[model samples]
Target: MSVDVITNTSPVIWLGRVLSGLAIAFLLLDAVMKLVPIQPVIDTMQALGFNSTTTLARGLGILLLGCTVLYAIPKTALVGALLLTGYLGGAIAIQLRAGNPLFSHILFGGYIGIFLWAGLLMRNNQARALLFP
Candidate 1:
C-alpha cells in the first residue's frame, strides 16, 4: 500500500485497537465519577469557573471512548480518526492551559505527531486534490 493509504487509514485502525482498553477504562472512570462523591473535583471545577467541568470532562471522555469503539469498525475508520484527533487536540489544549509540561508533551505533542503523520497517509487522492494537486 502507498504511504497515504497507510497513514490515513491504518494508524487510525491501529489506534482504535490499541486504545480499546484505555477507552474502556475511561468510560469506567466516567461512570465511577458519576456515582462517587467527588467533592474535590467539584471544588476544582467551581474554582475554575467551569460550572460543570467535571460533568463535561466525563462526557468528553465518554464521547471519545465511544468514538474509539466506533473506530474498531473498519468502515468507520475515518470518522473515528476525526473524533480521536479532535479529542487529542482538546487534551493538548487543556494540558497547555494548566502549564503541565510533562503531560502537555506526552498527550499533545507526541499524540499529535503520531496521529497527524499517520492521518496524512490515509487521505485519498480526492481528499488531497486541493492541496497536493
Candidate 2:
C-alpha cells in the first residue's frame, strides 16, 4: 500500500471530506436534539410511534452520538458506517410506517447513507479498495 494512495488530496477526496463533515454535523445535531428532548423532538418521536420518555430519547441520543463519533474517526469509520446503516434503516422503517413522503421522508436516510458511504469511499483508500476492487 503506497502512502500516495492513502494521502490523496484530489478533488474527489476533498468533496468527500466536505460531505463527511456535513453528515457528521447533521448527525451530531440530531443526537443533541434527541438528548435535549425539546418539544419538537418529543412530538416527532411521538408521531413516529415511539415513547417520548426522556430516558429512551437520551439513550438513543447516546447511541447515535457514539456511532457518529466513531464514523468521524478515520480509524473506525468502517465500523461506524455499519452501525449508522442499521440506525438509518430503523429511521426509514419508522418513516415508512408513518406514511411519509417517499423521497423526502422515507428515503431520506438512504440519501444520507449514500453520502456517508460515498465520502468514505472517496476519502479512504481501504474503503475504496474494499468496496470497488
Candidate 3:
C-alpha cells in the first residue's frame, strides 16, 4: 500500500505574488511609455531637468526593461532587486532635486521599492534565508 500527501501554500505567498505582479506591471508600463516617448513623458523629463531626448528616454527604457526582466526571473531576482533599488534611488534623487512633493513624487519610488523587496522576501525562500539568516 502507498500513501499520498498534499501540500498547501501559505496565503502570504499569494500576497507576495500579487504584490510582485503589481510592481512588475507598473514598471513595465513606465518602461514602455519611456520607450515610446510620448509628449507627457518628454514634458516630465524636462520638468525634472533631464535632457528629454528620445535617445536618452529609449536608453532608460531599455535599461528598465532589462532590470525588470531580471527581476521577473526567479534565478536572477536578487540581482534584479538590487539593480532596481539603485534605479529607484536615482529617481528619488531626481525628484528631490526637482523640488517635487514629498509624499507624492519623492516617495513614490520608495513605495515601489518597498513593494518590490517585500514581495521578493515573502515569495523567495532563498532571499529570505539570505537576508534573515
For candidate 1, the C-alpha RMSD (Å) to the true structure equals 6.0
lDDT of 3 by residue, 1-133 (tens): 2111111247777887889889999999999999999999999999999878999999999999999999999989999999999999999999999999999999999999999998888788788778866
Per-residue C-alpha lDDT of model 2 across residues 45-132, encoded as one tens digit per residue: 9989987898889999999999999999999999999999999999999999999999999999998898898788778888776666
TM-score-based ranking: 3, 2, 1
- Per-prediction TM-score: 0.49, 0.91, 0.93
Clashing pairs in 3: none
Q: What lDDT is reached at residue 96 by model 2?
A: 99
| Pairs that clash in candidate 1 | 4-121, 7-118, 7-122, 8-121, 8-122
Instruction: Put down candidate 1 lDDT per residue, 40-101, tens digits, no spaces.
Output: 65664454455755566566556755765654445665566566667667656655665566
Instruction: Return the clash pairs for model 2, or none.
Output: none
The reply for model 1, stretches above 4 Å from the true place, is 1-54, 102-109, 112-133
